[model samples]
Target chain A: MKEIVVISGKGGTGKTSITASLAYLGGKDIVLADCDVDAADMHLLMQPDFGQAKDFYSGLIAEIRQDDCIQCGKCADICRFDAIPVIDGKYIVDPLSCEGCGYCPRVCPTDAIDMLDMNVGKWYVSTIKTGTTMVHAKLGIGADNSGKLVAHVKNEAKRIAEEEDKEIVLVDGSPGVGCPVVSSLSGAKFVVLVTEPTVSGLHDLKRVYELVDKFNIPAGCIINKADLNPQVSAEIESFLKQENIGHIASLPYDENFTAAMTQGKTIVEYDENNLNEILTQSWAKIKQIA
Target chain B: MKIAIASGKGGTGKTTLSTNLAAYLAEKQEVVLVDLDVEEPNSGLFIKAELLREEEKYKMIPQWNPDTCILCGNCQEVCNFHAVLKLGEQIMVFPELCHSCYACSELCPTNSLPMVPQKMGELKHFNSGTLSFIESRLEIGQEQAVPLIRQTNKYVEECFSEQVIKLFDSPPGTSCPVIEATKDADFIILVTEPTPFGLHDLTLAVETMRELKKNFGVVINRHGIGNDEVEKYCSAENIPLLARIPNDRQIAELYSRGELLYKKIPGVKEQLDLLIHHIEGLESAGER
Candidate 1:
């Protein structure tokens, strides 16, 4: 299967909106994966029928047995994190504060502390309105293994693609060039960077592009809300040319996108008779690389 | 009082506000601004701070005494993060994956684990006239940021005391690092845009602050651009909107060229001076 990832240098760049539209057009033929675990919102549009989520453990959380507890404060003292907090003359472990480093339980003089398995987060395989399978997940508050979660989603999407023999896989990537993004791009066919027409957008575009180029992934750029700043849009076009990243099309500033989101619909379905044409064209370009 | 300038989104002026707010308060007080956005620390770029000190921060990795031990696998079994593994009488520790949780040493059957320090990031100190700043830089590809942030904060706590005001440029979002930075602050200044995504993330940030029970106020950056979603949310939630920084390119342009907003706009400092006084008043009133 050929996979295409939709990413933006920054949030609110319409990356998820565009990716949902593509999934709609590819209905049943594409397995969708969302790599934006930190603040995933694609589900609001996709409406995946989440099923059978399993725990994904990544970070360490310290466990202290209370019976052996000596109030020596050794763990709290050594905890560079102050994760082991002392309150009301009693020592307690704050999971949110705890980095799960096993240090506190190890240094406990009473041997009362022991590390226990924790449910860091959950991942789901679901069906969206597009008749495509969606692989998504939610990272628990203070959970540290987002990269692993991204990998889980991608692996599930690939598995479904092979099982269904789908010709295309669409993945929605998050806003930063961090570990999660790196996991999303590993072994991806091509990347479509959705960006806005602003200085921050351009800077983010450069950062994400560097990541795409580092992996030698063939890529293209799609500017969302391009009419917001014509000058910046032109600057983006030139930057893409210099970097040889294809400038796909600049989507105009449209209230239809927000309206569609509020109505719990993808832009294509929300304005199928008109806006679908541009979305379809974008899909065609993505197919070329596929 | 130490206050942290934070936001739910990146480029929402965390660095800009932190640097300028640092300078704004530096004139009257011994202020230190610690930029804890280690991923992309940019506070120093705007301030003409003179370098004072730099130190690398590290996490402890357990060194194994294989000769004194049998591969009990207890370390692997107790490890929730998979940072430890035992195979065929061989126990291996992955330092990069380790959160320095010392569990292996604590649970070792033969007591074969010893904590050995491993470098993870660096902390830099600088002074911009009266304002001193500290920044933490996590090594690229290093996944652990909470430890470094906690280390950075601890360093600041130990190194300085009674700065009339202290500011922390926190990382975006309401996650571990963000929580670690703003926990002990006297006030939290949340800078946010007014877009849908902006409002959405801002809600999450506010929820975190409320959950942590910290007193906070809002600073609406890029004001008058998106909508009133943030205003509505803040008003309904009883959160205060401390200030509304208008949408201005002069600020963005100066930011791109590495300049603080207070430096570009003189009166902005005066306004922040009043804001600082307000915070001081609140602290005193709170004590009452």
Candidate 2:
């Protein structure tokens, strides 16, 4: 199955809205993966049912057994993260600060600390309103290992796509050039970079594109809110030309994006003519190129 | 006071608020604006400051020493990140997956795995009058942003006096990078737009801040475009509504050209003033 990952270096650039529209247009032939586990919002639009849920355990967290009488501060000294602290004369582990490096457990004199797999989040495999399977996850509050959760979601989507013989796996990637973004881009057949026409937008687009360029994946550009700034839009087009990235489409900034989101609908379901045609054509072009 | 301006979603005016707020406050008092969004730092694109210094940042990773090596497989077993693997006679170290906790180097039976510094990113310092701007950018293809952000916070602490107010423009999303950026701040300003995506991510951010137990307020950007659900949510949650930057075309145009909005736009300036006033209130309360 061909995997088309839609990513925006900058957030709130209509990445989710556009991805949802594309997924809606793709219909039953695609499997959707929302790899933005830190702040997963695709379900807000897609309305995926959380029927099949699984505990996603990644990395490790240090748990101190209070039964073993050890307030010796040995674990506190070796913890580089400062995760262990003396609270009311008892050494306790702060779940948020702990890095689970396993140094404290080895140094504990009484063996009070045990390194256990942390249930950082939960992933779900469910059918959305469009009759396509969506693999998404929600990261626990203040939890690390989001990159692992993103990889889990992607693998599940790809596995289901292969099993069901789906034509494509459309992934909504997280913003930034960090670990989660890197994990979302791994093993993708093609990339769809959604950006806007602003100073920060272009700056981030170039930065994220640098990451994507390292992967050697074929990429196309979608300039959302192109009318907001014509000069930057032109600059973005030229940059696309210079970088050899395909110019898919330029979508005008519209209120329908927010309106549709508020009504829990995709742009394809909300707008019948203009946005529908553009997104449908964009999906077709992606299939042709990817 | 160190104030961090962050958002749950990107392109929601973190840089816009950071640059303009620093500039406006710098007119009277000393301020340091730090762009902690190492992956894609854009505050420097707006601020025109003279370069003070530049430094290359590095992170410690395990380097195998063949002479002192023993095939104990201790490093592989102890490593929780899957960064180190002992295959046959060679130990492979994946720097991207390593958290630099020094577990492998310290736990090795022999001193086979030595910790060494590898170049990861660069940190630059710039100055414009009383406003000092610092930006740290991660090298492309680098996966970890927490180490660089931690180092940048250390640099800021060592270089600037405690009296100066520091404003950190943090990366978007509620993740490790965001946590590292806001963990030490005296207060955080969560900038978000008024939309479903905004509200959704805002709630997630609120949960993160609460988990971190941070003193934070909310600022609604692009206020006129979307619905008022964000305002209602803040009211329900009792999160302080800091200010609302109206959705103005001129503001967008000014921002597109890398221009500061508070000086040209009256609406934006008013919001900045309100923010400054609120910050001052927080400052006095802290002193009390």
Candidate 3:
């Protein structure tokens, strides 16, 4: 199956909204994957039924047994992360700060520390309202290893697509050029970079495009709020031409995006006029190229 | 006071508020603005400053030495990040996966796996009068942001004093980078819009801040766009609603042009003043 991942280097550039609209347009032929495990929100619009779930265990966390009568401060001394702190005269492990290096347990004289597999998040394989399977996940609050969870979600989506003989896998990637975004791009056939016509938008687009270029993946661009700044829009068009990235569409700034989001609907489902036409055409262009 | 402006969702005016707030506060006193959003830092776009200093940052990773003949797999066995691997007769180190925990190097019996610094990113210090703007960006394809963020925080602590007001433009999402950016702040301002996506991510950010036991408040941007659920949720949860930046096209236009809005727009200046007043009240109340 051919995979097409949508990403935005900067946040809140309507990446999820556009991805959801594309999924709706794809209907049952596409298997969807929400790889934005840090802030997975496509499920908010996809309305996936939580029928299949699995615990996602990644890395290890140090747990101290309090009954062992020893507070030698050895574990706290050796930790690079300030995960272990003396709280109320007892050494406590802050899971959020722990890197799980497995050194503290070895240095503990009392053997009070144990490295245990951490259940960092949960992944779900469910059918959405559009009669297509979606592979999504929710990372634990303040948890690390989001890249692993994203990889798991993408692999599951690709596996299901191949098994069901689906033609495409549509992935909604995360913001930023970090681990999660990198993990989501592995083995992807094409990339759709959604951005805006703001200074930050143009700045971040170059950074994320550099990453996509490093992976040697063909990419397309869509300026979501192209009319927000005409000058910046012109600059972005020139950058797209110079970089050889396909300029698929330039969507006008519209309140229907937020209006549809507040009503738990995609713009395609909410508006049947200009936005619908633009998004439909955008999807067609993506299909033609990707 | 060190205050961090963060949002669980991106493009929620974290950079907008941070840059303008720093500019406003710098008018009277020395202020430090650190953009901890290393992955895609945009605060530097709005700040017009003279380049003061720049330095490349590095993180320690294991470098395998083939001269040691033991061929023991202890380095690979103890590493938690899978950055080191012992394949047949050779050992490889992947710096991107390394967390710099010193587990592999310290545990190596033959000292074959020695820790060495590898360039990860660069930090640049810019000065515009009383405002010191620091921006650190991770090299592209670098898998982790926490190490660079930690280094940037160290640089700030070494250069700036505690008496000056410090504002951190934290990265979006409730993950390691976000936690590292806000963990040491005196207070945090969670910026959010008024939509479903905003509320969902804001709730996640709130849970994260509470987990870290941070003193924080909320600011609503694009105030008139969607329903009042964000305000309602903050009230129900007793989260102090600090300020509301209205949905003004003028502000958007100014921000799109990479201009500080508070200087040009009266409404933005009013919100910044109210936010400063609230912060001063927090300081007097010892919330700082």
Candidate 4:
């Protein structure tokens, strides 16, 4: 099975919208994976009927048992993140500040610290209105370990695709060159980088392109909002040529994107004429290349 | 007061609002605009800042000294990220994957592991009139951004002792980088569009600020194209709508060319003026 992940280093470059359109045009059997767990919005467009939710755990967090207490203050002294707070002569661990390095558990002389795996978020396997399987997740607010959660979502999507004998997995990856983006790009067969025609767009595209190069993965570019600035668009096209990256498509800025979004529908589902043809063409090119 | 502008999703005008707001506030106040979106620090493009200095930020990664007699696998066992690998008599360390937690070094049996500094990003300082700007740029292909962001914040706190108008352009998302940028701010400006995806991610950003217990307001961009669902949600949640910048093609054109939109946009300067006043009013009220 070939897995294709749509990513952009800069956000709001129409990654989700383009992924939704491709899913719609790719028939009704492709497995969808939305690895942007921090802001998973593909479900908004897909309207997935979610099944049972499973809690996902990642890394370990130290919890101080206050009852077995002698406030020796050893854990507080050795803690790197200063997560152990001293309040009114009592010591406690702030879960937000803890990095789960497994230090306090080993340093506690009184054996008051118990390190346990944390329940960071949840994942779901659902079917969209178009009868496509979608694997998505939600990471808790202020929660760490988003990279692991994204890996979980992708793995589940791959498993379901194998079981159902599917061939392609269309993934909507998170923004930036952080851990979550790394996990999303880890094992994907092909990457579709969707960006805009702006200075930030070109700048961040280079950064993500470098990351894709590091992974030694083949990638293509789709310049969203291509008409915003003709000069920058031309510059982006040149850069793609210099880097030997394929230019799959260029989509002009349209008010229909926001209109369809406000109406809780995909652009193809709303205005099927102008935008649909461009999107279907891009999808065809992607399929041919992948 | 320190103000951080953030959004849960990218390309939502965080840099546009931050640069324009800093330029507007720099007229009367000593504004330090920090582009903390290290992965893609684009505020420098909109605001012209004379280069002052640049420094490379480093994090600790383990270096194994394998000549301590015993070839125990303790370093590999304690590494949470699997950065340390034991291959019979040799060890391999992936510095990029290391979290700099010091777990492997602390647990090394024969004291053969040493924590060494590895450069991860660059911190830049620039001077633009009265606006002193700082921006962090993570090296391409690096995974750790929170440390560098925190380092930039620390540099700001140390370099400036007196009170100044600090505006942080945070990375898009409610993850580690966003938390690092917004955690210490006195107030946060949550930028969003009027579309459904905007509102959906705005809710997550709001939840993050609420969890941090930081005061914040929302600024709606591309106002005319999308519906009033964002405004309705803001009013329902009692989140003050600071300002709304209309969806103007001219403004988008100028922004795409890296032009500051304060004076160019028809009513943007006035809107930013009012937004600054509202923030100062909130700041004083908090003091009271």
Q: If scored against the real structure, what TM-score would every candidate get?
A: 0.80, 0.97, 0.98, 0.97
Q: DockQ of each candidate's interface versus the true one?
A: 0.20, 0.75, 0.83, 0.77
In candidate 4, residue B12 scores what lDDT? Answer: 91
What's the distance in Å from true for residue B5, model 1?
2.7
Question: Which of the two, 1 or 3, has more DockQ?
Answer: 3
RMSD after Cα superposition, model 4 = 1.4
Question: Candidate 3 on A1-290: residue-level lDDT in tens?
Answer: 89999999999899999999999999999999999999889988989998799999998999999998398998898888888999999999998789988989888888889999988899999999899999999999878889999999999999999999998999999999999999999899999999999999999999999999999999999999889999999999999999999999999989999999999999999999999999999999999999
Instruction: Evaluate all candidate structures by whole-model CA lDDT and list the values in order.
Output: 0.77, 0.92, 0.93, 0.89
In candidate 2, the residue pairs with backbone N, CA or C atoms under 3 Å apart (3 or more residues apart, or in different chains) clash, namely: A11-B10
Clashes of each: 11, 1, 0, 1
Candidate 2 C-alpha lDDT tens digits along B1-288: 999999887778888999999999999999999999999899999999999999999999999987888788999998888899999999999999998988899889898999999999999999999999999999998899999999999999999999899999999888788999999999999999998889999998999899888999999999988789999999999999999999887887888889998888898889999999999999999999
User: Model 4, B1-288: lDDT tens per residue?
Assistant: 889999987899999999999988888878999999998889999888799999999988888886772667877877777888999789999987787877778777777888889898999899978999998899887887888987899899999864677999999888767888898898899999988899999999999999999999999998887889999999999999999988899998998899999887768887797798899897788779
Query: 1 or 2: which has the higher TM-score?
Result: 2
Error at A262, model 1, angstroms: 6.7
- Best by DockQ, which number? 3
Q: Which 10-residue window in model 4 chain B sums to the lowest lDDT?
A: B66-75
Candidate 3 residue-wise lDDT, B1-288, digit = tens: 889999999889999999999999999989999999999999999999999999999988889889983888888888888889989999999988999888888778899888899999999999999999999999998989999999999999999988888999999999889999999998999999999999999999999999989999999999899889999999999999999999988888888999998978888889899999998887888743
lDDT of each residue in A1-290, candidate 1, tens digit only: 88898887566678888888888888988899988777666787888888667878775567776777878888888775667777787788888777665666656778888777667678999988876789998766655667778888899899989999998878998656556777888998989999877666776687678778888998988988776777778899999999988877778777687668666688899896556788889888878865
RMSD of each: 4.6, 1.4, 1.4, 1.4
Q: What is the DockQ of candidate 3?
A: 0.83
What does fnat come to for each candidate? 0.08, 0.78, 0.85, 0.77
